[model samples]
Target: MKSKLTTTGSRLNPSQRPAICLGMPLYNQTRFLPQALDSLLAQTYGDFNLFVSDDSTEAGPGQIVNSYAAKDQRIVYHRNEYRRGLIDNWRNCFELAGEMDYFAWVGDHDAWHPRWLESMVQILNTCESVVLVYSQNVNIDNNGGILDKKIKPGISTLGMDNTRRPLVVCRQGQGFGNMVYGLVRARALRQAGVFPRVMWPDVILCIKLALIGDIHQVEEKLWFRRRTDRFSMPRQKRALFASYRPWYFKLPWPLVNAWMLTRSPPALAGSETGPQRNLRFNLAAVYFQRWWSKFGGGSWIGSPHEWRRGKATWIRKLKKFRTAVELKSK
Candidate 1:
């Protein structure tokens, strides 16, 4: 069910709009809410508005935000009358942003380095062509202790024309999702649609952003992503669509992504020349062929090796069963 959005604070005037806007969509994350807010508030760059959209059921999160809002006028708080799934709350942050030159989506549990905003803002201010700027990320446990897992390398589609950008983003295996949290050009992000209701929406957003302009990566690790089961696939599926959904809404990702990719060319294809359009189609075809070879059709059943292995395993089991039966008869 849909709920009315109630604001705890007043909106900003257009003339008073900040240069950067940090849209934070929070749920039931009271445990680390303070840390998350502190990390952003401590940023060296202070000319930004922190808009928080809360979808948590408990009053704990609201209370925390209220306490913080009392101290910081820059922090704007809005709460839903009832819980409205993940994507809506996320989109709400952007909707409340009014107008801004740059925007970033900060997670409720993720913490950032003191200079994160300062560093990212510098790039956006100086680079005319760059639309998004992100940094390397470090994984942290619930206790905020750094995990020893291998950090995925950063990827950049900078300098690649719009035709080649989608191909690179598709081939990118890990760490690309982090780019969604990076500072983005507000206009370009709007054009891409903040968060589309699709499987792997971050991946699609990155591809769309790539088509818009350049994406750059800061070499340093500035973002701390909390590793938690709250991000499990089942939980994500529920959050991606809505709070309530029928079983029929659940569909396999590959088929959905394939269909999404098929439709993407026309929707995102702006005024492109004939050759550019053909090149994009060819690149997408190449990616699909490679994807099939790696994961889609090539790795699954019907392979000769798998068939032989299954036959050998069944034969051994049958022989063992017969020997046991004969021993019992004797």
Candidate 2:
């Protein structure tokens, strides 16, 4: 499935090659698309290429992206023949990025302060051991009003052991999945594994990167995240799994956990020391707790048929949990 590029920006000279690639994977987000692009164009740090991969069904989104591409030679635009869903579109956008020192995924509905790129790039430049850099986020309502500020508190994993960093993410990280939008070293991102096509795959990628290097957080709120009520949590999960792994919803939660655990980066897999072992166990426990909260606890108390369903669910969960434990042990 090759994406046909619709428009290419002016080729950068060797000396003018971008320091970062801002990969924007967008769908039918015409309402907020212009704002997002404007924010990128306003970046204080301009040595970055903007690659907009449009998976929108309508022409509005493409038109907007093309309009931006026309004005800014740094903007490269590609519109897909059909909607490739979120994960595929994201992967395609990253792949479209030419060789660059850093890469950052930008959401269509999100906005950034003018200094966002500058602050992140500074960290990546000075800190060779850090693979990812992100700032605190501001949560905005759909209408573009600021709803909350300083949403994610800063936590610096700098100078931590590689194995210890991932555990910290698993336990204390406030914005685990949101780091997908952070500025990251291009080579480290490729090695950690380009966004996996799985539900909440960003979390897995974050863990993988933690196993390789430290993650630095900027205390300032430079990133803005728009919150929408269009898709509930479960609905989003169903759509994500359907698009990536159709069988994911049918399998027991433990099986899904086991599959994702096995997909951890090679760095994490190769280490079998005490800290690594503890990390695996703690992660598994967290997964089980989430699974039980969703499927096993309060939802079980109901009619006879519901009770029977609950019993079956528990049995399946236990069986799959044991299987995952055995696999991790080996």
Candidate 3:
């Protein structure tokens, strides 16, 4: 777990800060590591440290990190005792950021604009209520230029602080929450209790952070996220998680959401407008699809509605037709 830096009763004084730490976890990412590192080294903000924990099966990863560390003193290299998979590697990255005033995550395949860190830290210094800062981002290809400008989504929950609801529902993101768009306050990560055991690590963390305070949108596109065939959350894991009820609401959200829920004010609980209803409803749809697949195409009762062949039963007939087509294709 990541701990907050304390001086007085609150978070550490920002004026005394030396450098922001940028942390990343790498696993067999030799092809993309160099570009990611170069992006960081090319940052207009010079006062930052890059910590990399290598979990690659081969020495190629360590050698790449070492090559950078040799040339740039800001880069520090560490290898795991054994292989820590995705979640642990990221967990340890936040934990190792104990001394940093602010930090952000960088994936081996992700790149950033030269002004990324400089803009986020400046926003952090000015906004006390903003625990998380994110901006528009461009999605990039392997060569590290803009692939598409449209992948950047809005930070949909930005002004939720003004609403009077225990629950808040959001559509797709508008600005941030693009995985790598965040440059988070280190204290807030500790207070938020970091990422939990969720299928979407960045979304869960960003949601928790939003619950505590507000988000600052920089408007400029600084963060760049990578998308490819191999990089994804497994469909099975996503489907399984979608099937569960909003267990967080049963108790405090600490078990399911982050510590930010329990410690912060009551605003984030989703009781205000229709946020709570939308959450469960959205999750239900995701789960419903999974259940259909698991039960072999439809309800396990085996089309009891088929007995009543009426005009309203049109959906059932369409489903039967689809199933027949699938069987034929096999």
Candidate 4:
């Protein structure tokens, strides 16, 4: 079994580097920790390190980390005195990452196919513009039975698409720019600033990483996102949605509008990958449109779903774009 630790805390060189670091932020993943560790051990990419931050109360989570660390020095484990929640746990995981040429993260309940790293890492090693890579993960049940596949778009999007090759992203009618398939870069991540203590740190970090290079999507289901209720769906969108739902959302619309107007940078309101950047920029515009229609005024039709019917008949993936707008309906 390959270990998830880097023996020497060195960074990867430009050419054929020998290390990859997988930063995994976990809470009380005790139910699936063993299996998750098993999957990491089976990864085809050999040299790597795993830094795990456990926010699980009691010693259960710590024991799981210790058991794995004892066997594999690459698995560095740390248990927090108190729960750091999602943002802090993931932030600490990245901070603990050793010098790495490539970087990725796995949810504690998520399992990866053996070739997950081998495939994505190879692409990053060869592609100059590519900063991150991820695959179409299979959503599964607790016992590891496949439940459903992640439905992705048909064509390359401006700021988005499903797991496949490195490309910019796009938004269907629902909107674009929130692609959280775990395609990330160590350099990009390091330079992008730390993940904010927000709901969707993953999404926020991915957005910043996209600004650095093209995020390649690998069209394989090597990553298994277990839907056991501990966590489902990526933290990006859900976090943002949650952040805006508090009593503060009830604050004066004029004040909310002013915050965006005052803070946004004119040069870059999006990603670095040209197309994806534009997609992200416009997607935010769509979100704003809906916000104003609801919060700012009362008459804006951001119904990409209804608009999807306007698109050509051969597109089904536009539904994912529509999914983003469901909140508006409620």
Query: Which candidate ranks first by lDDT, i.e. highest?
Result: 1
lDDT tens per residue, model 2, 121-171? 776765667788887788889887888545555556765666566667755
Which runs of model 1 end up more than 4 angstroms from their true locations?
A: 1-18, 244-251, 262-272, 275-330
lDDT (Cα, tens digit) per residue for candidate 4, span 1-330: 011211223334657574677778776668888989989988877688888887776678779889889999889887776666666666778778867666677788878889987877766666556665667567789998988645443222223332222222312211112234354666676665546443334434554454456555566667777877642223432433423354544564434432332222334445335655454455445434443323312113323443445432223355656876896787
Candidates sorted on TM-score, descending: 1, 2, 3, 4
- lDDT string for model 3 (138-253, tens) is 77776666674456445433444433211332223333246334777787776556665544446556555654566656778787777644432234233323234344434422
| TM-score head-to-head 1 vs 3, winner | 1
Instruction: Name the TM-score of candidate 2.
Output: 0.76
Query: 1 or 4: which has the higher TM-score?
Result: 1
For TM-score, the strongest prediction is: 1
Error of 4 at 159 (Å): 12
Error of 4 at 267 (Å): 14
Q: Which has the higher TM-score value, candidate number 1 or candidate number 2? A: 1
lDDT of each: 0.74, 0.73, 0.60, 0.57
Q: Which scores higher on TM-score, 2 or 3?
A: 2
Clashes of each: 0, 0, 16, 20
Model 2, residue 197: C-alpha shift (Å) = 2.1
